[model samples]
Target: MLRRNLPSLFRFSSSASASKPVNEEKSRSVGRKAVSTALFCLTGGVALSALDDLAIYHGCSSKAMEKASKNQEVVHAIGEPVVKGPWYSASLAVAHKRKSVSCTFPISGPQGSGVLRLKAVRSGDDSWSTFFQSRDFQILILDAVLYVPGNEETQRNVKINIADNIPSPSSQACTRCPETRSPGKQ
Candidate 1:
């Protein structure tokens, strides 16, 4: 009778050990899943960064640079074909829903270097526009702040308006603002 009880005790112990292995296997699988998820998220973020860089390289920034480069005033302040600086030295602000952008970038030429400030708005609601769309930014206002090295204020370092698309002073009438002067109103 004692021997029969011993076998039964051994059987119960074996079943308990088997359940522990199953629990361990489940915990390992959960850990592996967590690591895989983290890796996927990291890769997605890296891809988006690469995409933004590519867009900045070939999109609205380039177009704004082209417009600024073409201006005679900008050319005189900086240099002709006003390009050739590192890409990382620019600031970009994008208004997602309103489809507007404000950009400031460093520009240099044979004579000197300056900062370009530009504000632009998309002409129409485009079907393919996302956060970083660059194709439709019509430049509304462009200004170049030149920094003249080894010269006086008269020689350089003045802000030049490259392009202006603001409303004419004669038509600025916002009834809500009491300080705003309108046409035919003092």
Candidate 2:
């Protein structure tokens, strides 16, 4: 009995059992770290998405859409009103330190569907940027192009100018969009 008990005491099986808890503890720590990292990434992604949505809604994007809706030509071409397209299909370009914004998005109505492209420049100081008010950031130059399919596809550029400056009939597109030239010029 003494000889059998002595062999058992010196056996490596006892040492292996002692180290099992340490290995399990190490694995638990690794799992915790992985979970923490996943949570952190999820939080960051949510925050960025919220910020993007906020910027889109409170910026010139909404202002341009609002101005388009009020235009009778746009209403007649597109039909009853405005309907925004899928978020993934829409594109937004912001430049000049957020003073300029260009938006291209799909819109539909009861009678027709088309793409709307608009560029707007912000006026006045951004001193009240911290305050979220639509009144603060005025849209200085809001111009849009509409493609309406009538008997044939008709392209119309609506240069909706603020600051009491009316768009001349010869200028079909805004200077901001360089691709288009004034009529009889090019």
Candidate 3:
């Protein structure tokens, strides 16, 4: 009888080793799940960043364009073709004319703001030239569409008001309120 019971005990120990095989398979499955979860997180992070850039561009484009359009007379009167560089650049010597300057506000991404410089050339007898460099890295994509008032050699009697900087998700508006002024020029 003792021998019969001993064989049964050995059988129980053998069944325990059978579980080792299933344990190995479960470990592998867990590893696979972890890898896939990590991949999903990385892809989601990239997509979110792209969406942020698109939002910023769209929100700022229209407002900036409107402001620049209002200053079109100045651009037509004083702006000279910015030759020798990209079409985006325009040199303008806005003397006594309204001028709206758009600056690339840095998004504070890893690549900081790329190089941006605008120049201006005055028109007249022995006209001079100057570079708009006060806020070198503050201007982004700028378009100076000229809208000249009829029959004017140059527009010198309009008000030049640069639109306020559009704050980003990471930035805040002015701490103190700017002095209020009457809406468009009277």
* Predicted structure with the largest lDDT when compared to the true one: 1
List, residue by residue over 96-173, the lDDT tens digit for candidate 2. 655666677777777566666666666556564643444334555554455555564454534323222564344446
25 in model 2: Cα distance from truth in Å? 2.7
Clashes of 3: 7
Query: Which is the leading candidate under TM-score?
Result: 1
Each prediction's whole-model lDDT (CA): 0.73, 0.63, 0.40
Record all residue pairs in model 2 with backbone atoms less than 3 Å apart, i.e. clashing: none
For candidate 3, list the clashing residue pairs, or say none: 92-120, 103-138, 103-139, 103-140, 104-138, 104-139, 104-140
Report the CA-based lDDT of candidate 3 relative to the real structure.
0.40
lDDT of 3 by residue, 45-84 (tens): 8885455333433334334444443443333443432112
* Per-model TM values vs. the true structure: 0.65, 0.56, 0.34
Count the clashes in each prediction: 0, 0, 7
Report how far off residue 131 is in candidate 1 (Å): 8.1
Better of 1 and 3 by TM-score: 1
- Weakest lDDT window of 10 consecutive positions for candidate 1: 163-172
Q: Provide C-alpha RMSD values for all models, in order.
A: 8.8, 8.8, 20.5
